[model samples]
Target: MAQKRDYYEVLGVDKNATEDQIKKAYRTIAIKYHPDRNPGNKEAEEKFKEAAEAYDVLHDPQKRQQYDQFGFSGPGMGGFGDFGASMNMDDIFSMFGDIFGGRAGFGGFGGSGTRGRQQHRGSDLRLKVRLSLDEIAHGVTKKFKVRKDITCSHCHGTGAEAGSSSEQCPTCHGSGVITHTTQSIFGMMQTQGVCPTCGGEGTVIKNKCKHCGGTGVEKGEEVVEIKIPAGVAEGMVVNVPGKGNAGKRKGVNGDIQVFIEEEPNDTFIRDDNDLIYNLLLDFPTAALGGEVEIPTIEGSKLKVKMEPGTQPGKTLRLRGKGLPAVQGYGRGNGDLVVNVSVYVPKTLSREEKSAIEQFRQSDNFKGDAATKHTIFQKFKNYFS
Candidate 1:
């Protein structure tokens, strides 16, 4: 498949475009490429779907922020499949047909003159998932026991009970809508609205289900499994489509928005994908080179060679020892940076002090002019 266009680009708006601007842009594109207007034009249909998909993300604050930060590779983005190329005319009409000033599929400039009941989408569920640095380095799947609204078993998602069934609404006569015609200066003005008596549902159930009280849904619990992508950061939201509350009357199921929270690591400080570790060396180790073991994110120790005369503030890099980039970014793993610091003895024994005094007058013990200059510069830089 071809690479998807940027959401902002598809909507012909800038990153800073307001919500109203995004909605207006989507409306313009939708009107131009509407299926009713373009008929059998396959390209126009695709454009219409594309515009809908773009509007879906750009108009939402959270989704738009994620798209800006991680592009299409962010959590709950393009490939995860909520809405995009797979969107159909019915889905578009149901969600955005109001922009055309009528109920979806009802008679209007963009409608097909067919009355369809509005499907209620369930509310999204928000959850916070805490992860360790190791878990963030590599992707992990988690299972959650979510309590939300579910379809009523007794009614089987229909509002009718037992042997009783729904009958066509007498007010709209199964059209699910009420049309009004008025003579105006522009000629006969016609407008369509949802049926008030049946609440737009063409059928009415005389016997309501006791289990759900005719709502077709009830309080229930579900075990949902979410596969989190690697390299996701804290505050990022991962959406699990159709895993939230079950819609009323068997409409669309809601999504689960998983907010990521990262736990602090005891051994490493994270900078983006790179991990920083401060290694403290004793006087002997700083003066004399030695191989020291360092802790890694994978719970393993890596031996690093400390060169003789290694100074404080020196950094050693371990390539590919850090966290991996998020999928779809096409970036490699980050590095582990080791910061070197020397430890000084705060208290010394009598023998240790006497031994250090013997070397105090020695030429090797005393700093040369260049060494004094270097020390002066270090002190000046620190103070500055």
Candidate 2:
């Protein structure tokens, strides 16, 4: 296989760039040098393909992180590395997303995030759920039905026959390599290639399984339960490890992602960590000052004291509310802001009109104050 290039450098971005920044960078260059835009131009095509590959990896949180840790020599460095390099122009497979865990990267998301050098892992899956504001306030448990490949119960993850066993390959002497001549940058040199007979798999099964057909796996349906934490917000993703497809070999299963989506609230809007809602107050009550009851995320009433002369759109805060921190810090609580909406009367009864007239007759009324300005008197005398 061909060696790969640094993903961060290929995208022309810093390693610390955020997801949005990565997306913007990729879009700008991808549009400019896109294969469609610059058709038949090999260089532009390469650049466009490279940008797409970068986007594929960078858009997914997990893959970008893995790519970050391993520049060009990581476990999956060569997985989709060829697409970014355009090594194989005629190959267009399913999304790398289809491979890894439903997250698409370059050529394909064919592998998993391995802590150390080991066998491959199955794909990961993503599932989205929408919840009401009240559901987000407290915690909830959700059950999911999923279909994935699982280790064959008959074979028990081994492809060998039940009575017989697997023996190491002999052509490559279990090392799975043979000597061959190849042309390199230096010159024609002798190198080791995979054993043609054994396919370089090292081990060969003497008797294959009849049920799994030597694949060591089968497709099945299963149900999984997820715990939605308190204070979870929309657009946030939760990772459930090792819940994806079973590996063909001894490789591990992938992960499952639960994406939280909040249903639009009729009464409130949520900002990052804060809650905003509207409260209506009558004109008299706003001017005279009074207490009011309001709805809260907790499903209980919150009592608030409205200040005298509280203006429309004025905001008041209630502490210790909002979504919980997903990081388990237990230190984040959002403030709830109540927007004051003064209810103006458009039509009034005779009794209400009489009360207003009597109020206009009080000292608070300013009917003749407009004509009693004294600064104008001094200026008038000077002018006369």
Candidate 3:
């Protein structure tokens, strides 16, 4: 296998970097090389894993110090995990928890490492949760399930059948990476790939475990509790640490990402921490002062007074009626915008025409004759 690149070099960070600085670096690199976007591109995946490994050591205060002084997978505290010694990758990942900010299960392996490593990490999982209008109004907790990876009880995650050790990979001779030379415009260029013999894992379990059949993980269900803060808008996401997949070799579990999905209510729409609802009223009711029932997010109705001769696009203020502060911003309510549409009569029945003719006999429909907007004059009288 080619000589492993320096962790700092891989992450493009100096050895004297601080934890926060290291985290910023890792976050940038991780997002850039995330496998979801690259899709089957081996190079990006390799860089992703490499940056992750560097972050695993450098992000933690203690591990960073140890690596700076000792270099290469240093002692596991009690003189464990000596170089060239067999160490469970899952255990290594878990022990280095301080690095990933409690999100270890999301990390994977098999791109570039020394060679011959044991891996076992439960798979990470994602879930979407929905909140009701009232729930978002007052803030609430949502519980959901996630199907994730767990350790196989039968083999204890060893992947070896009963009291047996794994055999050396014959393809790369226990070297997890293989060198491949190809002719390119830039002359003979050399690259590497994960050894197929051991699946980039230097060793192979000759006697596969009956329980796990060689893979050390098992399938399981994860229950997650998500707290939706008051005023949390739709599409907001909450992070629940260590709730993702159970890592292999007892590695730290991944994080559970709670994406907020809100169901649209017939009566309400949310804008940030505020609520909006449309109020429909008859032409006379809007013209004359009256009280109308409007639904609110509090699971009930509110009687709002409309002023006499209210015009189109008029708004009514409902103080403290909107959603509460999600991150403790401020207690505020949204104003209800009432758009007025004049209801026009389709057809006049004989009796309605006679009644209108009888009313026309009176001076009540006088003014605005030139405009023939006599109906509007009656609208003015409603409030009077």
**Each candidate's lDDT (Cα)?**
0.81, 0.69, 0.64
Q: What is the TM-score of each candidate against the true structure?
A: 0.69, 0.61, 0.51
For this target, which candidate reaches the highest lDDT against the unseen true structure?
1
Better of 1 and 2 by TM-score: 1
lDDT, residue 67, candidate 2: 71
Q: Write the per-residue lDDT of candidate 2 for residues 207-252, one digit (tens) a residue.
A: 8888888878888987988888877887788878788788775667
Residue by residue across 199-309, what tens digits does model 1's lDDT show?
777788899999899989999898889999988888888988898888888877988999999999889999988999999898788878898998998889999888888
Point out the worst 10-residue segment of candidate 2 by lDDT: 109-118
Query: Which 10 consecutive positions of candidate 3 have the poorest summed lDDT?
Result: 77-86
Cα error, candidate 1, residue 145 (Å): 2.1
List runs of model 3 lying over 4 Å from the truth: 1-130, 166-175, 181-188, 228-261, 270-274, 280-295, 299-305, 317-384
Best-first order by TM-score: 1, 2, 3
In TM-score terms, candidate 3 sits at 0.51
